[model samples]
Target: MRANKGLAGLIAGDTAISKVDVSTSSLWYRGYDINELCEKTSFLEVAFLLLCEKLPNLKEFQEFEAFERAHRDIPDSLYELFKTMPSYSHPMDLLNQSVSILGSFDEKNTLGSNSKEENLRKAMRLLAKMPTVVANSYRLSQGLTPVKPNKSLSYSENFLSMITGTETKDPLSVKTFDTSMILYAEHGYNASTFSARVTAATLSDLYSAVSTAIGSLKGPLHGGANEQVMYMLKEIESVERAKDYTLKKINRKEKIMGFGHRLYRTGDSRTAVMKKLGKALATKLNIHIWHDISDIMEATMIEEKNIYPNLDFPAASAYYLLGIPIELYTPIFAASRITGWAAHIIEQHNDNRLIRPSCDYIGPNARTVEPISKR
Candidate 1:
């Protein structure tokens, strides 16, 4: 039989855009490495690089920031839907639904065909409004009144404050969130983004495409990994007990929640930065339970089985410190990933392929015509 594919370890094609260097722990947008960008650039700067394929000069970035601010507000209907939703609904579901609702609003816009500058503007609205929707959705679920974003805050700070009514005012948290958004901005044909690309290939509305991606992101093996990581830590009571816990799971062949990744064979590049961010947050918050547990888990995993902490390990703690609801972890990922989704959608639209890949038949080989309703 020919090799079956989940496109596992296959080089589909060259993307001049960016590459995720899993083993080396590097991310680049166009040609600028993410570490450098995280130190020197804003998330919007990276977004411009991914979406428009170039760094925005000072004037262009200012114009883009102005445009994003103008579109950050969500419709009242979205707010009502969130308010009325039961606390039981995973926050990501609210985001998915809210994004779909946004599509209806976008449909009413003059840019129906994604053809004019207005269509691009509508896309910007989505990029801006998504964080608002996601943050508000969780706050609503928590029964905490959502705070309107203060334009004075940068995107990350505004998002944090909206989620938790307290103004963190910590520039480090803001910087970390921004960098995670940049790290997550795009990766070629990742699961959720591929889900986005596939939906967009049908010429679906951006919100529909993005919303579908949000749903996929909710899976534990996908964006839900971080939430699961926190849950797992919350399960194990202490660092001393972590070894036995992890060893038992590994021996049973149960997948460790945050220890691995398909794309990053050796390790996830983004994990190191998020881990640093998580440690800092833990120190400031004076709660090292999760971080301490993670340190033990990583040390044990590497010594026992050579497993490494992937992005989700630290992201779980970082988002928790940022006051994100556990269930909304992946939705937040969807919010950040909207950039990648939009980029891939635009790329697919320009190249325009139907993306029909072949599936091999493995069941009964052309079995003798089955008698109708065979017993």
Candidate 2:
């Protein structure tokens, strides 16, 4: 029997959290269309919706925001731990390690139960602290001082502030970043989220599941694509070089880092929203060259191969224009995706069978072991 490669088109399980409708080229979180959510709701509201299974009203939203702000500070020892690591370490690895370390700190709560209440608390804690970890780990790795989260600012503003080591109050920048978070907050069983569910199905603690997800996301084909996309942009570096660079890569049949996604044939639905915001950001920053180059490459890929850009394509330029470091891109993805991953983990724990699947016996069938030196 042939096995499904990478579990393509496999319906592994059911979810009420989100849906990816390829028929419509659309996504919905808790039944709300993503584009509408991005336009009207904050990232915190989306997080609440994903975790609680419904959008929060005003009083509930206020309470949820307060809880998140209250838990933003990780243990100081985590910073000390960050200081001891080599600067050359990848931010994702550091983030993965830091999350496991956080599990140790929360042993009392995490070890006791897989109850939804307990997991929800843990999820909210992870959601709150992940931005701190993503920002400070990168900063500390660069020999800079860690910045504390400013509760006065909104979630997106605070995250940007911590990463850049300055207050991020610009309206456009904050909105763009918040929109990216909402877009990335969830997708139905992408690699990382699936791995997280698999781990959770084993009754693993929330942190371990999240760490497993992070490890999966670190690969180039997944979350790391954003980082690679930025690097590719930098390599092209000029509008004049963009089309030639893209066509050369295409002629060689190289996999363009952010051009295609398996789930969407026409294009990633999230990409258009991000591209518009990214172009606006580029215009606002007086940095048209990146998006200009992107336009040439995007048109070339679609015209030549009928391929379209994914969310990572525009996100790379957006983050670059925002003055974010190339390396932090995937870690930032982790920060946003914690919401989705935790929701999956919670869902899995609530209704789980050990996620062990049978495999096709492709190796030497019915092989016999010979005694040592008997041949």
Candidate 3:
């Protein structure tokens, strides 16, 4: 029997982490609607919900918050490692290497410790330290000094602060970033999450699973779509060119970076929330060009092909308005997705499986091996 290509529509396994209802174009995390979670909670709260299997109560939230803040500092040795690397390296590559290095630092806790309690501890550490690694690695690469994480700020604020090398005081900016994180936090068994789960199913360490996920996310079809979207917008330059540019790409049968998704047909459920937030940021920053260009491009694509913009489409402009570097987009994704990846990793560890899938052997059928001398 022929299997689905890229395992499309294949129910490989079950998950309680998050659900993407493609029919309705809605997403829920642990039974909470993504829109409600964005409006009612913070990214860290969502992280707690994903990992702990429920939303945290007040005391639980406070304790979790404190733990995350406390562990934001990575080793000075990591900084030194970042400094030694060539500046031309991609941030995602640095991030992947950083997680592996971090695994080395916590081998005692990570190795042979797939217990829920231990995995949760490791997960929290990764969630806390990822921002530091992502921001500092990029900073060091740019020949700029790394900014230390400010525990006093909220998770999103501190993340922006570190990336920008200053404390973020704008509430709207912080909220937009937080919402983006929440939206990107989890989606059921996407490529990266599935890869992470596959690694975890082998009983490997949590960091190894996360490293695997990060590498998978570096592709343009995955988390790198956000970065590519930004580049495309920049290439289009202005609103006047947007329609023609989109039509040309469509006519040429080129895959637009952020126009469609494998999961959502009518639309990506996360897009509307992000588009609103992104437009608001555009208005706030007095920079209407990116969104204006995007609006035209979006309309053209829909009218021509019935294709809808995904979350990454608006997110690119949002992050641009927020003053984030384009290349850091996927790494920021990795930083937020560490929560979901860990949750999946922990779940896989709890129900241990080898995750070895069989494939149809379509190579030369019944071919016998012959010695070189005989040939």
Candidate 4:
């Protein structure tokens, strides 16, 4: 018997965290529409909505932000550890290692009961620290000193500052970055979230679950697609060559980096928000070439293959124009996605069950193996 390949279209389980409606090509965090959140809510607000199951009022948000700010700094030992990782290590691996080491350092993260409150505390810790880890890891690998986190900046602005070594307070840039975080903050039971839930189902600690999720997100088919999108555009280089280059890839049956998604057949709902942000940034910065190349490629693909661009397509260029390095793209994805991962982990542990599944055996009817000498 043939098993379902990659479990496509299979209903693995239920979640109240987010809704991915392929029928309408829409995504919702809890019940809030993603587009609405991107437009009207800050990233922290979206994250709060995901974790708390309701939108926070101004007073609640201020308290939450202050609490998160208190935990933003990783231990100095972690900074020393970051200095020791080989310069060749992938930034994602560094992040995973950092989380693991952090678990060892924080008793609350490792030894606390799997209560909702405890999980929320740990989630806030991870959310506050991940940006610092990612930024400092990238900087340390570049032989540069790590920058300290600023308490006065908002979450999105602080992350931009840490990575760029300059305070990020521009309204448009902060808005675009915040919107990207909100767009990426969560999706219903995507690969990384599923990995997180599965690990949580085993009663593992939060850090292990998050580390596993990070490993899952590092795959090219998932979070890394945005990084690959930028690489593709850099190769094409100009609008004049965009269509021919894309067509050539199609002719050779090469997989395009950011065209189709598993869930959305027509278009990713998040794409429009990111595309708009990218266009605004491009125009604002007077850097139209990336946007021009993207437009031609998008038109070419839609006309030739009927494939629409996903969020990654525009996000790659948007982050590029924001002065972000390509290597940090997925880590930035992780920085936002930790909120979703934490929410799912809490949900799974609240309604705990083992997630074991079966597979069909097809090798020689399961005959006994021969001894090594006889073979």
Candidate 5:
């Protein structure tokens, strides 16, 4: 009876924030090709570029590093609140609560207040805080005490060392994690990013906007795809079972998780990169289960659905290799994506437009009847 909106084909608003070059099939932060940056740059380099609109010089990087280090500590009240949380509580839920606690101690509510610089600073703080909050939450969920981020290590390295107490000589984990962050930093109008934008559109605070993203990203259809992929692999178990299982599912019109992508008909661009990483990690792990499972899933999807693996497929295995819990997969996604979300919010604010949308109502006629007795 009416259009569903789906927000499809609707130019609800304009953005110069960052461009998704779907035609060229590339993403650019500000004006630089992200692929080029990823090849030659560190995650911090890319983050600086996204926030400041330029690749940082030595002094700028050093200063930014110092600033990030200085604010690494969450307020005592926030930590106390976290300490009191139940061990069985989801990390995302803990993070949602922590965000509220941190906001309560806000020296500068720069998110909706007057200082643009302070808002930017706050954005950087939240971005830096995400991994800490996640890793710390995990520690709390277990009996272990939460570790603070190392000031000596870079952001990428710090996250790793925090999760694993021992010093790691393996640089690959940090590199891969950072690369994953850059790859997943932002996508144009995805569910979670759109959630952030819509929240910002209402002129709400940044924490509120990003908390909305946490909820949006937790869904199986969105950021949960990676975990779902792993679950699919576990269900199928061996390579031998993959073919029969996938074929039966397809015959029954069942959906295969992490196989078909809504956007990419050819292949997922991030999957192209992650596949390379997955192969390397597979070699390192030298195990048969995941290696064979990933291989077979790719093959099965191609034969039955004609769909290629999206970003989620390899990411599931990649995180597994890094010793990250499957349950925290999407939370890690939020950690990477909060930077992009913050940037998008800032961009939305500068333009200053409310993102109200129109819907074609179609359930009933305009006239209304009274209660049952009166009717």
Candidate 6:
């Protein structure tokens, strides 16, 4: 059998969660289109749809929101633990540690005996608390007081408020942030989601599985791409210089972050919605330089290499314009993606199997071990 490096096109297993359709460059959660969700629903509602397989009704949404709000305040010990961690540690690492620590706090943290209800409870707790963990970690690292969640704000607004330590009374910014979250809520078997599933297939508890996913998403090639994209845009510095910089990179055969996606040959469908939001923010905030530079780079890349920007491309500038710190990008991704990761874990547990795949051996035939002393 022919081997596929990175298992590029291999269908390892079935999932009824999300689909990434290459031909259309579309993403869907359950049966709903990503664009529709982004435009029509709040992130809390989208999270409900992802985790529960249907959009929440008024009563159900109220219940979900209440549960989420009630769990928003993480243990004070977690914040103290953050102080002991090195300030220079990547925020993703801190977030992963938080998840592991959260598992320890749960008396029912175990494998196998987790009923659907139990798993849902765990998912809700993580979903509610992850944004707080992310926001507080950043605040502590900056030598600032950690901001508590404001239940008065919506889920997306509360998260932004926690990070900024200001109430996001602005409707537009909150809406844009919520849109980003909905767009990011899920994709079919991305690296991090796959990692979560692999861990779950081993009969691990929900927290362990999610922690595994967070570690995987921390890699630059995955969730970190948006941060890299922002760095790249800043490096370009000017709209006039963007073309030269991008073309030089292309000539050098260097990989450009956020320019292309594996699943979308035409383009990322999420790009349009994000790009629109980015443009609106740039215009309103009068921080048009980043967006203009992005436009130039995007044009140059497509003209030179026919590559289109993924969702991460536009998302970087939008987040920057929103006054977010660059280091917090991937953590934001994690906060949004937690819903998707939880959904996959639940699905994996529903019909569990060990996700073990064999690799072809290309080393010396029948090699024998030698004694250390002989060597």
Better of 3 and 5 by TM-score: 3
Superposition error at 110 for model 2 (Å): 4.5
Report the lDDT tens digits of candidate 6 across residue range 89-140.
Answer: 8999999999999988888876565567778899999999999999998889
Candidate No. with top lDDT: 3
Runs with alpha carbons beyond 4 Å of true place in candidate 4: 1-3, 110-112, 365-375
TM-score of 6: 0.97
Using lDDT, rank the candidates from best to worst. Answer: 3, 2, 4, 6, 1, 5
Worst 10 residues of 1 by lDDT: 110-119
Flag regions of model 6 displaced more than 4 Å: 367-371
Q: Each model's RMSD to truth, in Å?
A: 2.6, 1.5, 1.5, 1.6, 2.5, 1.2
Q: lDDT tens string, model 3, 295-337?
A: 8988998999999999899999999999999999999999999
lDDT of 2 by residue, 15-133 (tens): 99999999888999988999999999999999999999999999999999999999999999989988888999999999999899888888665454888998999899989999999
Candidate 1 lDDT over 210-315, as tens digits, reads: 7778888888888888789888988997978888898898889898988877676667777777788778888888988888888888887888788788788888
Q: How does each model score on TM-score?
A: 0.91, 0.97, 0.97, 0.96, 0.91, 0.97
Question: Which ranges in model 3 have alpha carbons more than 4 Å from their true place?
Answer: 365-375
What is the TM-score (0 to 1) of candidate 1? 0.91
Candidate 5: stretches off by over 4 Å? 1-5, 366-375
RMSD of 3: 1.5
Least well predicted 10-residue stretch by lDDT in candidate 4:
105-114
> For residues 1-375, could you state the per-residue lDDT of candidate 5 as single tens digits?
333446555555665545766566566777777777677887777777766767899999988878877777776666666677788887778777776666666777745662446557767888777778878877867768878877788887887777766555476777777788787777667888889888888888777888888888888888878888888887887878987888898889987777765556767667767667766776877855786777776887787778888788888888778877777777888887877787777777777778776666678778877899997
The positional error of residue 161 in candidate 3, measured at the CA in angstroms, is 0.6
TM-score of decoy 2:
0.97
lDDT for 375 in candidate 6 is 72
Clashing pairs in 3: none
Candidate 5 lDDT score relative to the true structure: 0.75
